[model samples]
Target: MSVSQPYPQTYPQQGAPAPAPGYAPQPGYPPQGQMPGQGPGPMPGQMPGGQMPGQFQGQPPVQPPRTPTMAGAAERPNLLHALASESTKLWTTRSTLWLLICATLSMPVVDFAISSHYAGLDQVLRSQFTTDSSISALTALLLYVPLGVMVITTEYSSGMIRNIFTACPRRARVLTAKTLMLFVGTLVTTTLLSALSLFVSHAMLPGNFGEPVANSDVLTTAFRCGIYLTLATMFSYGLGAILKRSAPAILIMMAAIFVPFVVAVVTGAAPGSLGEKLMDYSLISGLLSQFNPQDAPATGPSATGILIYLAIAAAAAIGGAYALVLTRDT
Candidate 1:
C-alpha cells in the first residue's frame, strides 16, 4: 500500500508563488536563456543607459591635480612671497637667533663699559669718548659676518637652494629678494642697537665727556653707524652668495674687512701713501671717520665720500651675486 504521503505536501508555503514554469532556481546560475554575462540591467539610482546620475557617459573627467602644466610667469613666485620665505628662514634658524642676539646686545654692553671706563679718566674729550663708543658698534661684526654668510650658505649646505631655484626659476629675482631682506633686516636691527648704545653710553658718562642722546649729532651718528653695519653685512651676504660656502665666504669677508689693518701695521703704510689712502676706504676707517671727523685725513675722502664708495662697492657685489645666480646652476 502506498505509504500515506506525509500530510499531502504543499510547496512554497501558503499564498507564496512558485518558480516560473520550465525555470528552476539554482544557487550559482542566472535565469535560463539569459546571456551568461548579462546582469539585471542597471542598478538602482543608475540611469537606464548604465550612466550614473550627473555623470556623462564618456571618458573619466580630467583630474587637475594629476594633470601636468608648465609653469608660466603667472605661476612663478613673486618678490613678496620670496621675501616672506627668506624672512621666515632667517628668523627661524637657531644660529640666526643667537647671532642676532649677540649682535644686538654687543653694542650696548660695550658702549656702557667704555663709557664707564672713560668716566674714571680725568681728561677725556667728548669727541674721543663718542668716537670710542661709536667704534664699539663694530664689535658686532664679529657676529654679523657669520650671520650674513650663513644666510646663504645654510641653504646651500642643506640642499634647500635646489628647491628654491626650482620654485622660482627667475634666479635673479630670488637673489634680489634675499638682498632686500638682508638689507632691511640688518638696517633696522643695527639702527635700533646703535640708538640704544648711544643712550646707554651717554647715561654712563659725565655731560662734558659724552653728548646727550637727544643731540642731533648723536642721532645722525647713530643712524650713520646703522648704515655702516647694514652695508657691511650686505657685503658679507654678497660674498656668501658668490662663494656658496660658509667657511670660505667668512674667511674672505674677514680678510676684506680687517686685512687693511693688518697691512697697515705690518708695512706701516705711510700717511698720504696709496696704501694709506686705500686703508681710509676700509670699513673700519670710514666708520671711525664718520664717528669723529677729526680722525679723517685732511686730503683723503671725507666720511661721506667713503660711505658713498662703500655703497657703490656693496651694489657691485650684490649685482655680481645676482648675475652669478643667473648663470650658475643651483
Candidate 2:
C-alpha cells in the first residue's frame, strides 16, 4: 500500500497562526481556496470557477475581533512564566524526557566502564580513542533523533497539537517558541551527556583524548558539535509537525541517514566506481563527511555545514506543515 499523505484535507501557509475566533489575524488566514479580498463579498468565479463567496453562499461574514469589554490590554506573558511553561512542557510529557534522562546518565557510565580497556597504551589508545569517540558521538546523536522527533509528534498524536495551536494561535510564534525550548533542551541534554562522558573518561580512563590539541581547536569542535546536535534535534520538531506520525518520519529519517551506506555495501561487487560514487553523494556520507573534514577526525559537520543542512531539513518539513495547517479544515 502507498504511504498516505499527511494532509488529506486542507493546509495552511508559512508563518500563519492557527484559525482563531477573529481574535487575531493568522499568517495563513486566507487560504488560496479563498480568493484574497473577495471573501466578504462575491467573486467572479460564477464565470470562471463557479465558486461562490462565503457571504453569497449564506455563510457567516468574517467578523472583526471582539474588543475586551472589561479591561485594559492583556498583559504579556512574563519571562518567568514563559520559562516555567516551556520547561514544564519540555520535561513532563511522553518518552522524550525519559530517553533524554537515559542518554544523559548512560553515556558517562559506558565511557567510564570502557576506560580501562584502552588505558595505558597511549598510541593505540589515542588512535582508537579518536576514531571510536567520534563514532560514539554520532551514535549518540542517531539514537537521540527519535526522542527529539517525539517532542513534536507527541503533540499531534495526542491531539494536543491542536490545543497548542489554538492556545497560541500565532503558529509561527508558537513553533518558534517551541523550537527555542527544544534547542535549550537539547543543549542541556547534550551538555549533560558530554560532561558525564568527560567525567567518566577522566576518572576511568584519564588519558583518552591524546595529547590535547590547541585549546582553540578543542573548544571549537566541542562548541560546533553542541550546535550541530541541537539543530538536528530542533529539526525533528518541524519534521514531526509535517509528518504528524512518528513511524513514517522515523522511516524517512533512517533512510536519509543510513540508506546510502547500505546502497554502497549492496553494490560493492557490482562496480567499484559507481558504488563509491553513490556512497559519496549519499545522505549519510555527506552528513558525516562534514564532520571529518580533511581527515581531522570528528563527529559533526562544521558549524556552517550543519546550519545549511538543518535549514534544508527545516524548510522541507516546516514548509509542508504550514500548507496543511493554513488551508485544511481543523
Candidate 3:
C-alpha cells in the first residue's frame, strides 16, 4: 500500500490579535479578556487590582453586635420622670384636693370666728387675741401630716407601689422624690395660708394689732412657718415609709406632735423638772422656737432640734426602705 503525504498545518496570521495592549497571560488562563472558568473578565473600567471605579478597596472590618448591660440601665434613671409622676398623683387625688382646700380656708374661717367673738374686747385683749390667733395656722400641720402619710401609703394600699418600684427600682430615690414633692406642695400652701391669716387677722382686729408688712418679727415668723411645715411633712413622710401603713403612721405622727405637749401640760402644773424636760425636747416646742426664739421652751429643743430630729428620722426611714426594697421581692 502507498502512504499519503501529511498535509501542512496553518496558524493565525496576526498571532492571536497581539493579545490586546497591556495584557499578560497567566498560566492556565484563557486570555487577557477571559477568565479561567468564567465567561468574560470584569466589565470595562475595572482595574487589574480587582477594584471598580468609585469602589472601596478591600473588605470593611467586621464588628461585633452590641448587647445590653446593667450599667447602661442604671445610668438612665430619670429623676424628673419620678417628680412628674408624684406631682400628677398629688394633684389628681380627690382627698388631696379637698384637704388642700380645707387647709387654705380653715385659718381664715377660724380667725374670723375668733375675731367676731372678741369684737367687743378692749384693744389690749384684742391685741392679745391677734397674737394668740397666729397659732391657728399650726392647724394646717394636722392636715399636712395626714396628706404626707397618704402620699406613699395610698400607693402601698392600692398596690401601685409595685408599679412604682418597677418603674424606678431605686427605692430611696423614689421616696426622695415623693418627699420633695410633698415638701414643696406643703411649703407653698402653708406659707400662703399663714400669710393670709396674718393679714386677715390684722384687718379684722382692732387697734395696733395690725403689724407692718416689713416687720422683722412678722417676716421671720412667716419664713419659719414655711420651714416648720416642710419639716413636719418630711417627718410624716418618714413615718409613712417606715410604717408603710396609713393609720399607724398617722397615729404615730399625731402622738409625736401632741403627746409631748399633753405630757408637758399635765406635768407642767406639778413642781418637777420632768415636765420641763419633756417640754424642752418636744417637737412642737422646737417648732415654737422658730416663732419666738426668746420664748422657746427653756428645757425643750431649740430651732435646730426640729431639723436634727427630722433629718435623723428621714435618713433612717430611707435606709430601711432601701433595704426592704432590695432584699424583698415585689
Candidate 4:
C-alpha cells in the first residue's frame, strides 16, 4: 500500500461550480474573463483593460430614402387648363352639343310661335303681368319643367352623369361648376336663339312684329328666359343626381310643382282651395319662377324670394346627394 497503483480519477476545479453532464458555456459571451477551458487573456504584455472603443459601437447605420417621384411633382394648373378640360368634355360628347342646340333652336321658336298663335296670351301676359307681377306668371305655366328634363335627365338616361361625377368627385363642386357651365352655355345658346327669334319675328311682322321699341320689353323677357332656363337646368341636374333616373324623378318634380295647382283646380269648391297656398312651397315652381327683371311678365313670388327658395332647394338636394354618396356602396 506504500506505492498506490495508478487510479482513474475525475474531480471539480477549485472555486468553480460543477456543471451537469451535458451542459457547456454559452456561445458569443465569455463567462467572466476568458471563461472556462479558454486560452489565456490578451496574452503577454497585453493591457489589463481594453484601451479603446470604436465609434457607433451600439448603433446601426442609417440609410437615405430613395424614391421615383417627389412631392409636388409636375406643375400646378391654371384656370384656362381647367376650362379647356371642361369644354373638351362639354363639346366632345355629341349629346351635350345636341341638347344645347335643341334647346337653343327650340325655345325661341316655341316662344314666338306660341305667342303669335295665341294672341290671347299677349293680352293675358300684359294684364296679369301688370296687375299681379309675380315670377310664377313669367315662366309661362309649367311647360318649362319638361324642357328641364332635357337639360339633365338625358345624362341620367345615358349614364353620362357618372362620368361627370367621376371627373368631379366633390358633388357640390361639380354642381357649382355645372351650374356655371349651364349659366354660360345657356347664355350663349339663348342669345343665339334670341337673335334668331328676333330676326324671324321682325321678318314675320316687320314694323309690328312685337317691334322692340325703346323699352318694348322683349329684351327683358329674353333675359328672364335665359336666367329661368339656367336655373331650370341646375334644378334638374340636382334632381338627376338624387334620383339617377329620369321617369320617376320627372314625375316627382312635375307633381311637386304642379300638383298643388291641379288639386286646387280639381277640388275648386272651398274658399280658393286650401292647396293653392301650398303652391308657394313648391321647389320646381320656385326655381322656374326666379328672376323677375321688372319689364318681364309678372308671376307669383318676387325674383328675390324665388331665388332664395331655389337656393334653399338646391342646398337641400346637394346635402341629400352628399349623404347618399358617402353612405352608398358606389
Candidate 5:
C-alpha cells in the first residue's frame, strides 16, 4: 500500500479581506475610530448614557410616587379642617358623649330640687333664679373640665397624638383646633344646660317672684354663665396640653378652682384689700358674681371684665403649650 501525502495549509497575504459583517469585536477592543469609554452609537430615541430624553447619566430621573388625595388634600390643613377633625374626634369618643349627657341630665334635676325648695319659701330672693341657672357652671367644672382634659390626654395615652401630629404637621394648628373646638362645644353645651335649668327654675318659682326680673337680665346671665364655663374648660384643656396627662391636669385644675376660695374663706381676706381682690378674682367668686342682680351693680371688675381677664390667662396658657409643643419631642 502506498502512503498518502498530507495537504499543506496556506496563509493569507498582508492587507487581506476582513471578517464578515455583524461580527462582534473581541474583548478590550473598541470599534473603529472610537475612544475607550465610548460604545456603539446610542440607539434611536436613546441619549448618550443609554438614558431616555431628560434623564441623568448615572441614575434615571426619579419622580416622586403619586399618592391618592382626599378632598382638600393638596392644601395644607387650615383652621377649619383642624376644627372639623377635632370635632369628629371629640364627638366620636364615648367618654365625651357620656360626660356631656351627664352634664345635660344632671343639671335640670339639681336645679329643679333647688328651685322647688326656694319656690316653697314664703319669700324668694330675686337672685335665686340666676343662682339656680349658674349651678350648671359648677357642674361643668366637674364634668366638662375633665372632658377638656381628656381631649388631649386621651390622645397622649393611646399614642394617637403621634399620628395627629403626622397628619397635621403644624403643632400650633392642632392646638388651635383643640382650643376652638372646646370653646364652641363648651359654650354651646353650657348655655343650653343653663337655659334649661333657668326654665325649670322659672317653672318651679312662683309667677310673682319672676315678675321683677327683666327678660334681658336672665338672658345676659345665661350668656355670661356660658362664657365662664367655656373659659374654664379652655383653661383645663391648656393644662392637659401642658402636662400631657389626665389625672395631673384635672387635679391641677381642681386646685386652681378651689384653693383660692378655701384660702379666702379660711383667712377671711379683709374687704377691698389685695387679698380680697385676689379672692374676688378667684373662679368661684367670679362665677358667683355672675348671678348677681343686674340692677345691683358697681364692683371693681364686672363679670365681663373678669371674663376678659380669664380669657387672657387661658390664651397665655395655650400659647405656652404651643411653644412647648414646638420645642419638645412628641
Candidate 6:
C-alpha cells in the first residue's frame, strides 16, 4: 500500500472558480448546517411569534353586515295602508268617477220625473208622489252594485290582485279595508243624493202636500235609504270577490236584486201569501221595508232584518274569498 500511492491532484488558483451563473444554492447538498426542506427552526405546532395554525397572524376574519332588506321585511301591513291603497285605486279609475256621477244624479232625476208626472194630481196624490220620489233614491242600488262589483273584479281582470296580495299577504284584512272604504264612500254619496232628492221633491210639491213632512217617517226613510245603498254595495262587493269575474258578478248581482220582484210580478202572486212571501225576502222589498210609514208594518224585512241579512251575506262572501285566495294559485 505505501509503495504505489496515487499522486495528489491540484486545482486552478482562482479558488473554486465561482459557481455557474443562474444556479441557485442547493439546500443541504453543499451546505452543512441546513436540512432538506427545512427553514430557520420554528418549534412543532408553532409559527413565527408563537402563532398556531389557522390563527390570524395580522388581521381578523372579515364578516358581512346585515342589509336593510336582509334584516327584515320593509314594513308591516295594516288596515290604514290597505285603505289608502284601495281609496287611491277607487278614485283614480274613470269608471268609478262616472258611476259615482251617475249615482249622484240618478235620485234627483228620477224624483223630478216622478214629480212632473203627478204635477196635476190632487194634494193627496201629490203627497204620495213626493213620498215615492224620496224613496226612489234606493234605485241607486242598481248603480251601486256595479260600482262595487267593478272595484274588486277589475283588479282580477288587470292582474293587480297579484301586486296587492304581494304587498299585503293578509287577504281578509284587504277585504275588510275595501269593504269599509266602499261603505263609507257609498254612504256619503247616497246620503247627499237622497237628501237632495227629498229637498227637490218637497220644493216642487203643492203647498197642500203639507210643509215637506219632516216627521219621524221622513227621517226614517232617509236614514234607511243610506243604509240600504251601503249594504247593497257591500253585497255586490262580496259577490264580486266570490265570483272573481266582472261580467258574472254583475249578472249575479242583477239577478239577486231584480229577479225576485220580476218573478212575483210575472206570476201575479197573492199579496199576503207565497207570492208576497217571496217578495218579502227580495232585496228590493227588504230595502223598501225601511221606508214603510210608522203607522204601517212593512210587508218585507224590517231595518234590523235587512242589516242582519246583508251582514251575513257579506261575511260569507268575504270568508269565501279569503279561503280561495289562500288556496288558489296566482
The best candidate by TM-score is 1
Task: Give me the runs in candidate 1 sitting further than 4 Å from their true place.
Answer: 1-76, 207-214, 269-271
Off by more than 4 A, model 4: 1-83, 115-176, 191-212, 269-272, 278-300, 326-329
Could you tell which candidate, 3 or 5, scores higher by TM-score? Answer: 5
RMSD of every prediction: 8.6, 25.2, 9.8, 12.2, 8.7, 10.7
Better of 2 and 6 by TM-score: 6
Per-residue CA lDDT of model 6 for 1-330, tens digit only, reads 569879999766775666446657665463334356677566577677656678787755445696668438656657899899889988898887788888888888888877777777887776664356544665688888899889888889899899888878887788778888998998888877776777677767665344645655555566777877887888788788878898999998899878888888777768787667777688877766665534222576666777788878877876777788678866
Q: Locate the minimum summed-lDDT window of 10 residues in model 4.
A: 127-136
| Candidate 1: worst-modelled 10 consecutive residues by lDDT | 206-215
Q: What is the C-alpha lDDT of each candidate?
A: 0.78, 0.61, 0.73, 0.52, 0.77, 0.75
Please write out the lDDT profile of model 2 over residues 1-330, one tens digit for every residue.
998769666679888976634454459677445566666434664423344443455454456898875446766654444456667887887587787776565555566556666666675563443233444456666766777688777777888878866766666566656666777778776755554454345445545344544444434444555566666665666677677889987777767667767877887824346666556555455444433445521333443654576767766766676677656644
Q: Report the C-alpha lDDT of model 3 over 1-330, residue by residue, as the tens digit.
A: 999989989776875664468667777777765656756657567665667666577955445798878887665658788898889988887876677777778877887887777788887777653355456766777877787788777888889889988878787778778877887888887777766776677677766454555455565676677777777777777777667889999999899888987898987735447777777777767666666677765455666666677667756765676677567765
Candidate 1 local lDDT, residue 216: 79
- Measured on C-alpha atoms, candidate 5 has an lDDT of 0.77
lDDT, candidate 5, at 66 = 88
Q: Give TM per candidate.
A: 0.75, 0.63, 0.70, 0.53, 0.72, 0.72
How much lDDT does candidate 2 score?
0.61
Model 2: lowest-lDDT 10 consecutive positions:
294-303
**What TM-score does model 3 achieve against the real structure?**
0.70
Q: At residue 192, what lDDT does model 2 achieve?
A: 51
